[model samples]
Target: MSSGKGGPGLPQERKVVTEIPGPRSREIQERRLKAVPPGVGSVLPVYTVAAGGGVVVDVDGNSLIDFGSGIAVTNVGNAHPEVVRRVQDQVAAFTHTCFMVTPYEAYVEVAERLNHLTPGDHEKRTILVNSGAEAVENAVKIARYATRRPAVVVFDHGYHGRTLLTMTLTAKNMPYKEGFGPYAPEVYRMPMAYPFRSELDGPATAAQAIDQITKQIGAHNVAAVVVEPILGEGGFIEPSPGFLPAIAEFAKANGILFVADEIQTGFGRTGRLFACEHEGIVPDLITTAKGIAGGLPLAAVTGRADLMDSVHGGGLGGTYGGNPIACEAALAVLDALDAEKIVERARQIGDIMLPRLRRMAEKHPEIGDVRGRGAMIAIELVKPGTTEPDPARTAELAKACHAQGLLVLTAGTYGNVLRFLPPLVIPEHLLNEGLDLLENAFGG
Candidate 1:
């Protein structure tokens, strides 16, 4: 058995006894076609039967190297024993009272812990939610309520969530925004400081963005300026050094709330507890979800007390928000983050990925850029001799890795970026092997 929880943890090695999907997974996929909706996209059609460490074992008994971490939700690892134990204990005690109706100590404890752990030590408040989309929506609601403004400003290449307001806030159009509008009104957009693509420096980009908001949207009318300190879906574009702090500074000075959407970059995934910490950008509101409760569905919008408190009672909750079971799992995840040194582990992941990627970039002209912080990193693929996005090549590389039992996730507005979000608990040898497999894909 693997040392920690999260089901029967698979071994550290990648083993494929059958084809990538194998026969059993293919049979299950056939069943899924009849039962599940076509809207639900499966990253890997091979169903995960047992997952642990750095591997996910499908029902066909194929063990694949995990590079996605279930889209960065399992930082500690799948079915982490500690998280599993907490969930089991909580389940035995009582599963749900609908926190809104019955209230639970675990919910309050989780809120208290978030208030303390998030960036600023000032008086803060946290409202738990069910997913990243919910957390973001609530943050926008709170900001709009507190600021009494009709407009919200989001940057270019920033992905908030899938809900109406968030999809409006999201810069991507095809899959996320196409056919989904008429989106929420009064959501304004500005250019983000994409160093690789933009000509300006960090401060210069910030200046231009602020200027555009002031001229185009009128900063006074904007309720909040939402950003991903490190862009999530729009590519793992780490805003240039001064970009985030500059944006936050503008938001504060202009009576606009700065909302950090840390859904993909939070909870030790970015080498820090929050990606904002990397730039000393303490936003007025921070939305967290993905890595908060291991594999559990839990999210929170933690923010300044006065802003969050501005919303009236019964205005900021859902039936499933902050369920006791998710709270318990989150508490255990927090313990693992602190005791097991997850933040440092993320830094170590970057240390391993950056150097190897940089070397690979040196050799492969198709790799246009290698960027990210801590474990949340990516490589942008482009034409061999130019900066034009090469999405076909990117897809080909990812498919090559998938064929070899290495699970890799791709992202970017151009769909030419391959992201790596390995679990912090991934074994070093497994990580090395995964990288080696990735290199082989690039070589082919």
Candidate 2:
């Protein structure tokens, strides 16, 4: 392992020199509980001091193998050399003048890159934002403005964001939507093309969604049909093939914009520039984040020029929408995506992990499904004799993995899915090691 506590180029191996949450981490957690509100939750309680490559070094110097790349935000790895260099240079040059106030070249450059990188060769425009939620809100705003419609159609098990409108768009209730009631109006949740649980196929699911749109919501009243090409927080479920294309076609035929929420699956996370490309669907608007700016807070909405330009002047920007440091980081990230062959690396990761995960599934009766592509993969847990969700076992498995120095994330509407989103830059050895830990967790 590269010798270091934290920062880039550290050893890409897991070293559990202490308990998962050692004494130092326990002290920090005690401090955190008092200082931070209870609503702000964390999956792993180990406070991180440094993170790089495939490992995160905790306060107690325990290096854990990362199976979750900060929920897919660090696809290019944390503290990449180019990203660090660009961010440092941009910081020294100037912190923020507010793109809306005086404007800057980095913001425009980031927009241009997004416009070019997103799906479809058609002339497109972009608006940068602070987070994925902001990007989704902006995309919906543009679609509504352009289409002159009030309703937005979302799918079951879709996760947009935590903001007011996005929260309404999301389907989960307990944690995301539970006491937060009286959500935004005119946002409709439709049946998703979930291949594992639902009996409907791709074309059939699309037909049902279309029927609901026309009969229930009225097609003309719909502004957009927003979906995660592959569901993210809702268990990394990849919909049945042909489902996305059929939906996009219906949306286009009805003059409704199809928005692809690529926040979790964009920027080389899924072996492609965007997950929507896997199904050959070109969205009218795409919301991107999580992996856009390395670890920096940056998101974007890129779409057809005509639709994006529909918004009135002074209606599309935010105070810190495109901070220069983040823009420069984004530029560096975009460059590194190509320069380092990160997209190909994601595909290679899938090739190595999927088969191993399948083998693990064969031995574990609790593993009901093994799904996802590239570096974005997951296994759903179920009862031994039936399809009933086994969230308790899923949590137990994750905790076991954590104890063994493998950091894993749990998701799903039922909370029974264990998702693995390793950084594309993670070493092959670490990937194998992480999977081995996961297999061992299944045993216990």
Query: What does candidate 2's lDDT look like per residue over 50-124, in tens digits?
Result: 888899988777899999999999988889888889999988989999998999999888988888889899999
For all predicted structures, in order, the TM-scores are: 0.98, 0.98
Clashing pairs in 1: 5-79, 5-80, 5-81, 6-79, 6-80
lDDT of each: 0.91, 0.92
Candidate 2 lDDT (Cα, 0 to 1): 0.92
For model 2 the local lDDT of residue 231 reads: 99
Put down candidate 1 lDDT per residue, 207-296, tens digits, no spaces: 998999999989889999888999989999988889888888888899999999999999999899999998888889999999999989
Off by over 4 Å in 1: 1-9
